[model samples]
Target: MGGNELPLQRIEPVSVSGRGLPRWLRRTSGPVALVLLWHILSVTGVLPSEVLAGPSTVLSSAATLIETGELQEAMWVSLSRALTGLAIGGSIGVTLAVIAGLFRLGEDLVDATMQMMRTVPNVALIPLLIIWFGIGEAPKIALIALGTAFPLYLNVYAGIRNVDQSLIEVGRTLGLSRLAMIVNVVLPGALPSALVGLRYSLGIAWLALVFGEQINATAGIGYLMANAREFFQTDVIVVCLVVYALLGLGVDFTVRTLEKVFLSWRPAFNGT
Candidate 1:
């Protein structure tokens, strides 16, 4: 008997039309609903304005802060510190990940130590950092750097190590030098993972900054929050929290956009 091939099943392409509201509205609906609910609750006295300020109260607080230039100054300080730490720590992470991933000796010497370091809570080092570097910008930046390093290192290392063996074989067969092979074959393949690390690291950087600034900050968002806490200014505190949320979301969006642009050659399901 002749061999028979099974028939392939038909698959329908995904559709967006009539599924829901327009994309922009769908994206924003959740937050809008939450805000409306919050306003309703606040109006009904289900939530106290002083204890847990509603969206309107928080918005008003933000406007007042902005008018006073307090929010703007605090934002600048916080952003500067975060960016500085990100640059330094991210550089170190990528460099070390590359070395450790590429060389057994480097892995043996560095990767274990970093793994141990990451296990320790970054905030625990704040006191030590203060003692060593004084209650200055140094400790804050250092804490942020520490927080920023580990995720990037782990992701980058994994990405490098996980590059397709067949691609490496192809590089060797083509008589590519070690440097050329890594640059052309390994790094490109590893970029997606590295970007993942970047997003995680950025998140941790903000968290670390929160702790770092709260410790002894003369000026920053954390300082503003601390001051608001002292007076029980729930509205101001909520404003700071909102700003942090927006900042984190902004950075994540930026990284995702960059990933899409750079990874155009790779076909993967990005939500349509």
Candidate 2:
């Protein structure tokens, strides 16, 4: 190469197969295919409208519900119940986890009891809840709280226990106080596991909401579905089911966003 001339760099062709499709298209293809098949079956009478509504019918019903504002009202009520229950359950779970994780005495007192309680199905407590709190909102919210608490407790406790011993030693060498060490090193280290617990708790919160609303609920998506069932409005029922799915998806996305933000310090694997 001449002193005044730039070296010719090797130019490689970009791989078309990997880059051709947009990520959104690739992600949506499976659901789109399933929907198309559903539409075809609905039109061909292999799937009856009475038994299950097609995607188009469901969409139209959702639109109608939106225009009427009933869907929005029901959604707000349902969302409130789910969030309230989550807050109560999550607070209790974290508090218990922290106490038990930090002290041997606390663990002895709390962990075994929690383990025993966790095995009992939340649904089995519904009758007792109804008797204790009556057929009102209390029973429903309590059911949700009971359902969400255990998964969070287990995960957070495990996370705290799993914190690296070397990091604890480093804190000791730095002469960090117990509170400071926990705040700066331990909590941060345990955050990824806490977030995992949060995701699982959020999913259970929705499921609990479903069963909770079944107990003489006058409002919410479950009520809407129950009413639709009486009239055989399969389209409306499908719309409610879709709404539940979309809400769960939205919350999961929120958690993933949180992981990106809070857990950014840690390295993670992204599949090829």
How close is every model to the real structure, measured as TM-score? 0.92, 0.94
Q: Judge candidate 2 against the unseen true structure and give its global Cα lDDT, from 0 to 1.
A: 0.92
| Candidate 2 residue lDDT tens string, 1-272 | 55898878977545423566797899999998999999999999999998999888999999999999989999999988988898999999989999999899999999999999999999999999999999999999998898888888999999999999999999999999999999999889889989999999999999999999999999999999999999999999999998898888998999999999999989787644
Residue by residue across 118-166, what tens digits does model 1's lDDT show? 8999888988999999998999999999999899999999999999999
Which residue runs of candidate 2 sit more than 4 Å off their true CA positions?
Answer: 1-20
**In model 1, what are the clashing residue pairs, if there are any?**
none
**Clash totals, every prediction:** 0, 0
lDDT of 2 at 216: 98
Model 1 TM-score (2 dp): 0.92
Model 2 scores worst on lDDT over the 10 consecutive residues at: 11-20
lDDT, candidate 1, at 138: 94
Q: How many residue pairs in model 2 have overlapping backbones? A: 0
